[model samples]
Target: MKPLEGLLVLDFSQFLAGPSAALRLGDMGARVIKIERPGTGELNRQLSIKNQMVDGDSMLFHTINRGKESYAANLKDSEDAASVKALIAQADVLIENFRPGTMEKLGFGYDAVKELNSGIVYATVTGYGQEGPWRDKPGQDLLIQSLSGLAWLNGNADQPPVPFGLAVADMFAGAHLVQGILACLVRRGRTGQGGRVEVSLLESALDLQFEVLTTHLNDGGELPQRSAVNNAHAYLGAPYGIYETKNGYLALAMGSVIRLGELLACEALAAYQDPKSWFTQRDEIKQILVDHLQTRTTDEWLQILEPADYWCADVLTWKRLFAHDGFKALGMVQDVGREDGARRLRTTRCPIRINGERLFDTNAAPKVGEHNASIEQEFKLRDAQPSVGQHQPDGGERI
Candidate 1:
């Protein structure tokens, strides 16, 4: 059996961070039910990436929210809020990514949910933490990256600060929330009590740069210096970046500069025999290597370097990576189809294995309110008592 086979998760999160964590839980065999708004559902259903849509919903939504059931309800309505609270009472976990006070206003905050079900693992994601002055700022990936010094880590020293093409902040926060949730789950297994987990995009973004950031903090506040040429890592030394070859690019990891010079037959690299000069004179050494590497194709350089056990590889684009035997051997891709089989989406499978078997789920994301009737019936939500008045001090609408 999968680790989370019997657990039930109520995912109130709309976009990348919280839903991605819910998806990971589902991959581990949790029964995830997404509580979305009526009519409009989650905003991510319309948040398309590269304008790509599938089956009337954004591909971004499907990629992160697949293999889940959706139940539509308006938390602002007394009856709907009561029904949702009832569902939360039976849930093993609850995840939400609304702004700090939104859930509290709806009466589903962690304190209220804990009272409903004392053993529920309550997880939340925000732009910043609840107390920060920037808490109200939009929790967008690019903005978080820019604010957390992540953009400064990319590109050459002279080039403009570069943010990652992907939503690193959202994904990292999701992963962190999962870690916290799983830890709480373990503790619950032993203590018969659950706790709260809180992660913010800004916090996750900062944590991602812990190694360099900590170094900067302790080492007399020395700022990281990216190579002026072939910048890969901000703190790493020469031959630690990608270089353009005759036909393509080659990436070189940390290795002996002298050995690399001998292998590539570049006489200039031999002069930097002192390891200290590798960092101090990195730009000049990198320039020489860059000029020399451009004379040979990537494969030609790989052929010379690979045999000597050098830390070098020919960079592969998506198309090339897909065609490679190494990528195919991993079996990382899977095809998921909607219940009606009207369409199918081919995407990467969960990068995890249990008992030597890779996890695969064929279910696609549910349309808005697709499972509302069945979920209401199964949870006996229709019999729930609605709150009599405004939001309560305990954060319960009135269940």
Candidate 2:
């Protein structure tokens, strides 16, 4: 049986963080009902028009919102708002990503929702949080990167702070949402009561850089300027970092001090190899190692490094990595929601497995409001109340 077989989740979140948590829960066998703003739905629907489903659905939206049923309702409208509140009352979990005070203004915040369902786990995702100095400030992936110091750590010292490309804050906040929801669920199991589970993009991003943050905070030292391509490994000298290959790049690292010299394939620096030397003269050692690595092609060094049991990897682009046999063997990627069964609609599987089998059901993303009738019937709202009469405003407009 799946982990959360009987649980129900009401997803009022859009974009990344909030939807991500619902998706994970659905994969683990919860009944996730995704509530969208009637007509336009979630912002993610228009994120990648070109990559939309072959059948005209939003693939970008499907990628994260898969495994959940959609309930389109305009909370602003009276009839639709009733349905939303009814769904909230019947759910075990409720998730939203509106800015702080948004839910409260709309009358669906923790207090409001709790009044309807006191045992419901309420999760919120925001740029900063519900209340703080930057609570209402607009927060996104890049903003968090700057506030959390991640942008400053990447790229070269001479260059401006660079983004890490991927939306680390959004994704990490999604993960944090999952963790918070689960924690609340477990706590509710004992107390027969649910509580609020809150996570922020800024806080999540900062939590991800704990190692660097703790060190810098304790030392009260100014963060070192951004390090260059080869210089990113400044913390480790010689035998640690990317080395050039004939056609591409290879990463070689000897995290354990004792393994550094052995991994380098250079017998000349064996004496300076006293790992302690790295702490004292890291700069000189790195220069010598960098000079030596430039002497051999990546393949040549890999051939020796592998035999010596060094931690080494070839840096492959997404296309190359996807085609690699290792990915298939490790079950790192798999087709999702593909009816053809010919492996055409490929998607990376969740990075989790159970008993060697991936814990995912290949379900298509819902067409907008696909579950309206079913959810209405299931929640017994059809006979109890009329639909909210007011029409929902178009999304993208401030409420």
Candidate 3:
């Protein structure tokens, strides 16, 4: 059985971060139900990547929301609010990414929720923390990256504040939320008292930069210098970036510059014998690599580097990586849906493996309120309107 086999998660948040946390819980066998607006559903339902839509919703939505049910309700509507409150009372977890005070205004804040379901783990995601000047700003990935100084760390030195091509802030925030939620679940298992988990995009983005930020904080507040040439990491020195070869690209990790010089027969690198020069003259050293690495093909460089146990790899695009035996062996991709697997959308499976067993769910994401009737019947939601200020037992009682 999965670790979260019997848990119920109400995903009240839209977009990547909060939905992703709920997705992880669903992967671990929690019964996740997205609480979305009636008719329109989630904002992400129309937020498409490459304008791709699947089964009437964005493929992006399907990617994050697969294997979950949806319950459509307008919180402003009294009957809908009452039903949702009833659901919250029985949920093992409740996740929301509304702006500060929005939940309170809707009567689902931590204090209000605690009264109905004392053991429900409440998770909130925001642009920033609850109390801050940035609390009201949009909780977007790029905005968080830009605001948290993450964008400065990407690309070469000459590039202007380049944000990550991926939604790194959202992804990291979701991962952190999962960590906090799981930790709370562990604590709830012990004390029988559920807790609140608050993760913000800005905070998670800063946490992502902890290593470089720590160096900056203790090293006399020195700002990180991005490498002028082929900068892979803002803090790393030479040979820590991807280089172009005669054919493909090769990624070289941190290693002895002298040893690399001897192996590549590029005598210029031998002049920088002092390890300190690796950082002090990072651009000059990387320039030498840029000029020399392209002298041979990526495969030629890999042939030489691999035998020496050097930290190097031939960079491959998704097409090449997917076809390679190394990628095929991990079985990273899976088709999800009820119909013939060949016809369904292909996506990545849960990365987590328990007892060496991979977690694979084939169910597709639900349409708006697809499971509403069944959920109403099962939970008897129509008759579960608790009185205002009603309090459940302090201990968690999963129904």
Error (Å) of candidate 2 at residue 121 is 0.2
What clash pairs does model 3 have?
A: none
**lDDT for each residue of candidate 1 in 130-237, tens digit (9 for 90 to 100):** 987898998888999999999989999999999998899999999999999989888877667778999999999999999999889998998989999999988888
Over 4 Å off in model 3, which ranges? 338-343, 387-399
In model 1, residue pairs whose N, Cα or C atoms come closer than 3 Å (at least 3 residues apart or on different chains), thus clashing, are: none
Model 2, stretches more than 4 Å misplaced? 49-54, 225-229, 255-284, 338-344, 385-399
lDDT of 2 by residue, 1-399 (tens): 767778888888887888888898888878888888777788888777566554455677878877788899888887788878877766788899998888898889898887777778899999998777998888778888998878877765467777887889999999999998888787777666778999999989989988877777786675543334455643445455665655678786666444555666656566675677754555466555666677777777778778767778888888988798986577755556634342245566677676666786677677678789988888886556432322121110110
Candidate 3 backbone overlaps, count: 0
Candidate 1 has a TM-score of: 0.96
Whole-model lDDT, model 1? 0.89
Candidate 3, TM-score vs. the true structure? 0.96
- lDDT, candidates in the order shown: 0.89, 0.74, 0.88
Runs with alpha carbons beyond 4 Å of true place in candidate 1:
384-399
